[model samples]
Target: MDDQTRLELEAAAFRRLQKHLMEDRTDVQNIDMMNLAGFCRNCLGRWYQEAAAERGIEMSKDEGREAFYGMPYADWKANYQTDSTPEQQSAFKESFAKNVENQTP
Candidate 1:
C-alpha cells in the first residue's frame, strides 16, 4: 500500500476503536481496561493530544478527550463512569506506573 492508503487505514482503525470503546462498550470501565490492557480512554485521549502536538495542533487534554468522547469529559464521567471495585483499582494502581511512564497526563 502507498503511504496515503496506510494512513487512511490506520485512521479508520482508530475511529473504529474509538467507537467501540466510547459508543458500543460504554459498560467497560477505564480502570478495568487499564488493569487488563495497560491503556484506556484517557490513554487514547493522551495519544491523540500527543499526535496533535507532533503536527503543531496544540490540543489540550480536555480538548482531546472531548474530541474522542464526543462530549465533555465531565459529562461522560457523570453519565457513564462507574465506581471501580477494590480489585480493579489495585490492579490499575500497579499498571498505572508503567502506562504513564511513556505517555503524557
Candidate 2:
C-alpha cells in the first residue's frame, strides 16, 4: 500500500480502538488497563498530544484528552471511572515502572 493509504488505515484502526474503549467498553477502568495492558485512554491522549507537538500544533493535555474522550477529563472520571482497589494500585505501580517510567520523551 502507498503511504497515504497506510496512514488512513492506521487512523481508522485508532478510531476503532477509541470507539471500542470509549463507547463499547466504558466499564474498563484505566488502572486495570494499565495493569493489564500497560496503557490506557489517558496514555492515548498523551500520545495524541505528543503527535500534535511533533507537527507544531499546540494541543494541551486536556485538549488532547477531550479530543479523544469526547468530554472533559473530570466529567469522564465522574461518569465512568471507579476507585481502584489496593491490588490494582499495586499492580499499576509495577506496570507503570516497567512500561512508562523509564521512557524518554
Candidate 3:
C-alpha cells in the first residue's frame, strides 16, 4: 500500500477501536484496564494531546480528554470511575512501566 493508503487504513482502525471502547466496552474499568492492558481512556486523551501538538495545534490536556471521553473528563470520572481496591492499586503501580512501553503513539 502507498503512504496515504496506509495512513487512511490506520485511521480507520483507530476509529473502530475508539468506537468499540465507547459503545461496546462499558464494563471495563479504567484501573482494571491499566493493570491488565497497560492503558485506558486517559492514555488515549494524552495521545490526542500529543497528536495535536505535533500538528501545531495548542490543545489543552483537558480538551484532548473531552475529545476522547465524549464529555468533560471530570464528568466521565464521576459517572464511570469506581474506587479501586488496594490490591488493584498495587498491581497497577508495579505494572505501569511495562504497560507504558506497550502503548503506540
Candidate 4:
C-alpha cells in the first residue's frame, strides 16, 4: 500500500480501538488496563497530545483526553472509573515502571 492508504488504515484502526474502549467496554477500568496491558485510555490521550505536537498543533493534555474520551476526564472518571484495590495498585506500579517510565511524552 501507498503511504496515504497506510496512514488512513492506521487511523481507522485507532478509531475502532477507541470506540471499543470508550463505548463497547466502558466497564474496563483504567487501572486494570494499566496493570494488564501496560496502557489505557489515558495513555491513548497522551499519545494523541504527542501526535498533535508532531503536527505543530497545540493540544493540551485535557483537550486530547476529551477528544479521546468524548468527555472531560473528570466526567469519564465519575461515570466509569472504579476504585483500585491494593493489589491492582501494586501491579500498576510495576507495570508503569516496566512499560511507561523513562518514556518521553
Best by TM-score: 2
Which scores higher on TM-score, 3 or 4? 4
lDDT by residue for model 3 (1-105), tens:
899999999999988888788778866788888888878888888899999999999999899988888899888778777889999989888777676666556
Please list the residue runs of candidate 3 whose C-alpha ends up more than 4 Å from where it truly belongs after superposition: 97-105
Worst 10 residues of 4 by lDDT: 96-105
Question: What TM-score does candidate 1 get on C-alpha atoms?
Answer: 0.93
lDDT, each prediction: 0.90, 0.94, 0.84, 0.93
Tens-digit lDDT string for candidate 2 (1-105): 999999999999999999999999999999989999999999899889989999999999999999999999999999999988899999999999988897765
* Alpha-carbon deviation at 76 in model 3, angstroms: 1.4
TM-score of each: 0.93, 0.95, 0.85, 0.94
Q: Model 4: runs farther than 4 Å from truth?
A: none
lDDT of 4 by residue, 1-105 (tens): 999999999999999999999999999999999988989999999899999999999999999999999999999999999889999999999998887896776
By summed lDDT, the worst window of 10 consecutive residues in model 2 runs over 96-105
Residue 46, candidate 4: how far off, in angstroms? 0.1
Rank by TM-score (best first):
2, 4, 1, 3
- Candidate 1: pairs in clash: none
